[model samples]
Each structure stands twice: as structure tokens, then as C-alpha cells.
Target: MKKIITLFAVVVGLFAFSSCTTTDDNFQEDFDTYPYAFEIKNVDLGRVADNEYNLRSTFQFEINDNLRDDETVLIYRLTSTINSNTPVWQLIPRTIYFNNGDLVDYFFDFSKVDFFITARANFNLLNRREYIDDQTFRIVLIPSDLAATMDTNNYLEVMNTLKLSENQVKKVKL
Candidate 1:
């Protein structure tokens, strides 16, 4: 009885380990076997105050091919919200090209006079496949009427309090 139980346990362990293994055979049918991924990092926003702000974001992406066959473009938009539950207003739309190397810097300005700001990056690969990689940051711009009451620390505090919602991670491929 002991021998039988030991053999059964061994068999189960082997089966479990085998089941955990993955291979290309289990890959999705539409999976693009690209050997690289676009990585976005070091996203920073600086407050210029007086209804003006400076935006700077940097990213490094791997390029598997140099023939320009694989095109990776970054699409970004600025969003603001008066209330958390309502729709975010899209303030600006910009596109950056990435086809030559592994790094790209995206910079722009926001003078819409809004208190809240969020940026979303939509990466389009090969002009067909799409992935959503977004980052959100807070911008504290002093209202023209209240410039006298503005404190630089207030902007820093707002930035530190900014959080990325789960909706930001949800990818919508086009």
C-alpha cells in the first residue's frame, strides 16, 4: 500500500510539472512573434505656473528590424476631469515617430488652464497592431486670477498625490 501511494504521488507531481510547461504550440493564432517591446519610462511634468506648464516624457523601445518594416508610433492625449466619475476631457493629441532607434523623447506644452492632467500613450506597431501604455501625472497651474495665492509646494503636493487608475491599464487595441 505504501509503495502504491508513493508511485501515485510521483505521477501526480510529474503531471503537474508537465502541465506548467509552455511552448510555441500554445501561442495565440494572431500573436505577432516580435522579439521586442516598447518600454516607456521617466515621465515627468514641470509646472511653469501662470497658466503654462512644460511636459516631458522619455521612452526606450527595442527595434527588431531596421528595414523600417516595423513601425512603432506613439500617440498621446492630455485628459482632465472635474469629477472622478465623469468623462475625461481630451485636451491635446500628439504623435511621435519611432523607427530608427531604441529611445524617443516626447515633449509638449499645456496651456488649457485646467487643474488636472493625465497623459495616455497608444503604441501602434506595424501600423496595424495597437497597445495602450499610459501614464498619468498631476499639473498644478496657477490660475491667472489667483496667481498671488499660488505656492510652488502646492503643485508638488498635487503631483505626489496623483494616482493612475485601473482604467489606464485597460488596453483598447485598434
Candidate 2:
């Protein structure tokens, strides 16, 4: 009985000790920091045949399937650039008001497989070539956790926070 008890105690001790040792390599951090960005240049808005007041454009770009519910999509319009390197990006759902009291809004929506850019105005956009043609936009995808901590309105800040450089951004053909 004494020998049996000793063997049982040794087995239990061995099991407990083995279970206490955890390998870091076996564990993965829940935080996902990988971010990506893409640009659409000179994309002409097409009039929705059914709705004259709406000008829309669609692009097919695959987003990470796992991040479909866990990510934030931010869209910006390339308003200007200094020295041909530093781009000034304006965040949308932006509203542009003309002197004549016509207002046009730029906004976007996205799914896991594609995204749509839409221009909606109080008046028909067919006559306003400037608002419908040759528009440039940038789409940035980041984790929801990072998006909450960053200043999304400031394009430069967001870029810096994401550790993204101009060369890193790829231009997508539309």
C-alpha cells in the first residue's frame, strides 16, 4: 500500500508540473495590428439610371474575411498635395456647398468583397462634371481597436499611427 501511494503521488506531481509549464509560442495575442491602404484615382462617377440625383461608382477589392466584423473602413478624398509627395486627404461623408446653394455630399459604404462610392446632391449631378468626374479617393482599413484610439479626421496622423508611408500605398486601377 505504501509503495502504491508513493507511485500515485509521483504521477500526480509529474502531471501537475507538466501542466504548469506554458509555452509562449503556443499562445497568440488577440491584438491584430496589420493595416493596409489603397487608392483609387481618376474614377468617374456614373449616374444611377434609376436615380438621376445619385452618382455612384463601385470597386471590387477583397478585404480580410476575418476582419469583416472587426475592422473600420475610412475613406478620404485626395484634395491636394504639396511637393507631389505630401498628400492632403479629406475625410468623407464630406459636404461641399456651392455658392449657388447647391450641396453635394461624398460618402462611401463597404462590404467584405467590395465597396461603393456615392455622390448625392440636392440637385442632379449630371450637369456638374467637376463633382462627378476624375475623383481620387483613398481607402484605409485598420483594426477597430486602433481606430478608436487614433484621430481619424487627421489623415497624416492616421498614416503615422499606422506606420504607413506613401510608397506603401498602392494605386488601384478602377
User: TM-scores, in order shown?
Assistant: 0.23, 0.71
Residue 15's C-alpha lDDT in candidate 2? Answer: 90
Candidate with best TM-score = 2
Please list the residue runs of candidate 2 whose C-alpha ends up more than 4 Å from where it truly belongs after superposition: 1-35, 49-66
Give the worst 10-residue stretch by lDDT in candidate 2: 22-31
Evaluated against the true structure, the overall lDDT of model 2 is 0.72
Put down candidate 1 lDDT per residue, 1-174, tens digits, no spaces. Answer: 999999999999999766644333222111122211122223433434322234443221122232132222222333345576642422223334457532223344432221223223233222321212334432222223232333323332222222223333223221
List the candidate 1 regions with Cα displacement exceeding 4 Å: 1-44, 47-52, 60-74, 82-91, 94-174
Clashes of each: 0, 0
lDDT tens per residue, model 2, 1-109: 9999999999999997665442232322222323367788887777764223333444444344445587788999877778676778899989988899988888877
